[model samples]
Target chain A: MAVILITGGARSGKSRRAEMRTRAFPGQPVYVATAEALDTEMEARIAKHRARRGADWIEREVPLDLVGALVATDGGGARLVDCLTLWLSNLMHATRDWEREVTELAAALPRFKSPVVLVTNEVGLGIVPDNALARLYRDAAGTMNQTIADVADEVEFVVAGLPMKLK
Target chain B: MAVILITGGARSGKSRRAEMRTRAFPGQPVYVATAEALDTEMEARIAKHRARRGADWIEREVPLDLVGALVATDGGGARLVDCLTLWLSNLMHATRDWEREVTELAAALPRFKSPVVLVTNEVGLGIVPDNALARLYRDAAGTMNQTIADVADEVEFVVAGLPMKLK
Candidate 1:
């Protein structure tokens, strides 16, 4: 049971690389998407991403409660969470009890039966945000990434669409 | 002091409708976005939404603590939350203490000072999901919508891009 955490900067091709890595595992790939299309442009973008996913990919669009989603996919062979950064952002945007949620996700990861690839963004490299809310997001995302990274068996950083093995 | 709760199915043009409604108010609008782009597609979606918003619109992308976001926008006029379903979904996905987050959000709505529009999705309209996670999302979304509708001064349901006033 290997849980891999993939992190990178924006437009760093982290998702693409993560998807490619999923193919190396034995069973059919399960993709857990953290996206919700709120507009036409987003709808179009979602369409494009869907088109790109391999024919063998089983798509599960769960905008909330990924631990539940993961539990439901208990028999999965290979699982890939396209991005943890968005999950973190979504958590930061919705719940007041963020710390508890992070703790829950951390505890839930080890229970997965299959090889898991968790994707996230490196928010610490960017300039510090001016507003309190932005600062909060940056801090929360950075912390969540750190926590997830500590749990996974392997942690990889993608830069300019290139994957660099960190651990 | 109207407190409107806008609920609809996905891609139902509710956000655009909310934007138009906010413009009818006197002061500049406050757009509270609860989304963060975690991939290329999401980044594009965020950019597109940003393009549509005017300079007068004070954009605050609050991902987690919506009650706190509403509190900050207390004196700000015509506050429009792009969508609460997404926010609720985010909280559920991220936090272990989802009950507490939901309670806080429900408790904070009435305390809002300016006229507010709460945007969310009507997830109860769909068929029951096959799995436990999907069922949980459906149930949680239904509960959150019911809670907001109970306190809102006006509730509107959007279908095929048309708004039907409920209250």
Candidate 2:
């Protein structure tokens, strides 16, 4: 089973690219959303993504415990983890150990039975933030992206709706 | 002449990559810096870049008038504009029209006698900024990147110190 990691900036078409990759694999596509509609903005974004993805996907909202969710959905069609950065945020907000969890996910990715296409953001590519929290989060994001990309069989960095193969 | 655009996140080795490209050209390399040492942090970063690049190259700190600098340095060896995003920031801060300047830079790139290697940050990949100004800057950066990349002879999206060719 192939583990593909698609990364890019905001509105850089990472989700669309991931969906196309997930659909390329055999079986029904599973959309594992890491985002929870915590606010109107998020709810609206979720709705837009749902509209774009259509109703065919077997959707699951697993804000945290991604490894467990992946395990539960292993035997099905390719699982598209719509994003990992939001998952990291969720973990941090929940006081979960993000570094350990990221490492665990990286370890679990190789043994998956079904193809997995994960999307993540490249958050560190901007000016250094003014706050310490932002700095920490961006560093964590960069580390997480590098770790997952190392284990994934394929990696793509998307920009302006175009995907460039990184691995 | 080749006009290369190297875009990546902060500390993503874009300057190092640009230096390599510039050095590959035949004559003495010109380092067109868009940064002014306004703060100690900036001064340190600029010093680090200079240390890494060595002292053999000609350097010019043209924070706003990039097109003018390029035109003035036209017939020399490859000119490495060690970034465009910072230049864009300077333009916006100076109340100059960035879109028009970016378009002008694109138009001027093709006419240069020497090669140009420009570095830029991919600032819009992260979570939406909390402030409107940050959001506006990111949007501006995204548009500028896309516009410049459209005319670039070579475009690379770098991550984790690795280069991924986009064009």
TM-score per model for chain B alone? Answer: 0.92, 0.98
Query: Candidate 2 on A46-165: residue-level lDDT in tens?
Result: 999999999999999999989999999999899999899999889988989999999999999999999999999988756678888888899989999999999999999888556888
The window of 10 residues in a row where model 2 chain A has the poorest summed lDDT is: A157-166
Point out the worst 10-residue segment of candidate 1 chain A by lDDT. Answer: A156-165
Show model 1 residue runs off by greater than 4 Å: B1-167
Q: Which prediction has the highest TM-score against the true structure? A: 2
- State which docking tier applies to candidate 1: incorrect
lDDT tens readout by residue for model 1, A86-167: 7766777777466777788889888778888888877664345566776777788778888888888898765433456789
- Give every collision pair in model 1: A65-B93, A84-A119, A92-B63, A92-B64, A93-B63, A93-B64, A94-B63, A94-B64, A101-B95, A101-B96
- Candidate 2 chain B, run of 10 with poorest lDDT: B125-134
Model 2 lDDT on a 0 to 1 scale: 0.90
True lDDT of residue A37, candidate 2: 94
